[model samples]
Target: MQQGSQKIYFFLAMTAVLWGGNPVAVKGMLGEMSPTMIVLLRFLGISMILLFFMFYKYGKAALPPRKHVPTLILMGFTGVGLNNGLQFTGLQYSSAVNCSLVAALSPAVTAVLAVVFLHEKLKLRQWLGILISFLGVIYLIAHGSLEVIKNLSFNRGDILFLASQISWAIYSVLGRGVMEDLSPMATTAWAGVAGTFFMVIAVLYQGTGVTFQLSNFAWLSMAYMIIGSGILAFNWWNEGVSSVGPNRTAIFSNVIPVAGMILSVAFLQEHIGWREIVGGLWIITGVYLATRRSSMEPQTT
Candidate 1:
């Protein structure tokens, strides 16, 4: 590979690795901070930085047109607001390993959503992929037990994670329309601001405003969330996309759950067993099958 290509790959790989650590970092913070507080503060900082970048890029155009305001707010609410809220709260009850493994199903979920909302038809391969991915999530939630399904018993954390993914999928679908009017970074910045508004209400309602007395570890985790996962990872992923195209950049995302599981086990002392291994593999394989562009599809240079 050319040196330039190699560098893009490195950044893409690092983006996945940093994203993999996101759940672990959030899980770590649960001990010292409330979920609402964490989401609020983390996104607030990220939003500010993104806003600065957007302004730099678009100047006065950074402010989205008035007609797009509601859509952006909805995107923020679903994508950032509800997504992170459910995720962090779920993490309070779920293992970071489980969170990461389940999260690997996002591409599949987004594909299914596209079928529903975008009127897109799926190929037989994509259908099979979606089915397999669904089964994988069911297996994880059931803890590899048919008896749990028979008894209607499921992990609440897993269910919330699933809900959170759906919320994020909605955001992604909604974003397709918004991106026609605004750049991705601008959409993210404005939506992040709107999401921060929602989180403020959430924090107020939860009555868990920041204590400003966080432990050293909590502060470190906060910095990682805002800077490492939020800003740096995002910028790197965008760089990969701009350099190598989204398909090539997307391939790097397959590394995220693997990294997350390993980091969870290594850092959080989380245990993983046959279920996580098997289910995670199923999710990754299914996502690849569902989202990969076929040879017949038009290719972007």
Candidate 2:
């Protein structure tokens, strides 16, 4: 039990580190790659790596069942293509700290979706948790002042980030049952293939010309987002979820913002003011209280 607990911590910590650095890396790439192209390249890279591993382990590249194929295609678009495209778009408008911290509201968003769509019941404490989490989000969105939100004086990047969260929530709700039918690796691979179509559309729509002379540093950042966050962090998160439980494992997601906060400041030189500190605290605490009761729920997001 102790060993498993330690492993969960390790896996979750690794998840925090990689995911933490993900936005910082993406923000750095904004100037080098167009948003859709970044999404396209990420899907392509992850698809290849996952397919290779799947074949090596199982000696066959198993595909999603026919019944699940259509749904998986949708997941691929929403989860990777759209999610990443908006993420990069929002990064163009917002600070890395704001983006990462706003994403921390995902579990809270998932809880609400559960209550509404899944028709799940919650205790009084859970409702309170939801309220508190939203309050934190509101505060963060308002940037420590209710006046800004009231006057609609928010950054375009922050709004895009919130939209990205919705995209992620949709993916979470839909990706749940798909994971039941396919291995995590297979599901991700198929989705990446599906997302490639959208990436092509984005490129053609934007009339992006091929730029092959990207600096080595830009390529390195893209590779980290592809390999580090997409592959390693994903598997580590799944390992943690399997060893502990989704509810317990989900707590580590809070660490992602903390790590992001540090790296954003250290590397990106983004400022972390009062709103982020206070808002992040409430969001993290609310998630803990809301999900304190464990179930066999899959942490899809």
Candidate 3:
């Protein structure tokens, strides 16, 4: 039990690191690739890697049951297709800081969705935490200036990112059954493969030119997203969920924006204002409050 707990912590930490680095990696890829093209390549890389693992592990049984095909497709669409599509599209127009800050609200959104859709009950403290977290996000969006709202011009990208967050929350809520039934590796791999197919179609429709200039930073970025965030992060997160259970596992997601903020400052040399720091703290604290458990339910067999 002690060893398992340690492993879960390691997996969660690794997952946070990879996820935190994702915005920076995506930013690096943006110069040479369009958002649609980048997302397509990301899923392609994920699918290839996952498929190899599936074949090596379960061989033929790794292929999902025919009855599960629809569920897998839905998972792909919600988790990978729409979630990533909106995120990348948003990143094009918004600063990485904004994107990360918005994404930090995922726990709150997930909690609410779980209550509404999954029939889960939230304690009063959890509801307060969600409210506080949302307010922090709002402050971050406004950049300490309520006046900005008067002059606010909506960036298409920001709207897309918001949509992406909602998409991810829905995916997390709806995936409970699938997660209970399937191994994390199996679930992610199948969904990744299905998402790749959809991404290819989207890429073709967008008609964005794909390039492979090794000298460009875009290639490095693409590699990072594919190997680090796409494959390793998902695998680690799934392992963490398997070990710790999803509710507890989900708390680690709160660290992502913090990591993103630090990376943006260190690597991207982006400016961080006082409001951002304060707002980020509020969001993180709120998420912690929201995700804390009064008791653990028995693990599924």
Best by TM-score: 1
Q: Which tens-of-lDDT digit does each residue in 1-301 have in candidate 3?
A: 9997987787798889788888888876677677777777888887888889888987897787777778888878878889988898777787777778778888888899998988988889899889988888777777777776567854567667678888888877767777667777777778877887888788889886666664557777878888888788887887776677776787788889888988888888888899889888888888888887766545532
Local error of candidate 2 at 30, Å?
1.0
Best by lDDT: 1
Model 1 whole-model lDDT (C-alpha atoms): 0.88
Pairwise TM-score winner, candidates 1 and 2 = 1
Per-residue CA lDDT of model 1 for 192-295, tens digit only, reads 99999999998888888568888888899989999999989988887787788877777777899999999999999999999999998888888888878877
Off by over 4 Å in 2: 59-61, 294-301
lDDT (CA) for every model shown? 0.88, 0.82, 0.80
Clash totals, every prediction: 0, 0, 0
Q: Which ten-residue region of model 1 has the weakest summed lDDT?
A: 292-301
Give the alpha carbon lDDT tens digit for every residue of 245-292 in model 2: 777788888888889889999989999888799988887788677767
After superposition on all C-alphas, the RMSD of every candidate to the true structure, in Å, is: 1.4, 2.6, 2.3
Query: Residue 22 in candidate 3 has what lDDT?
Result: 86
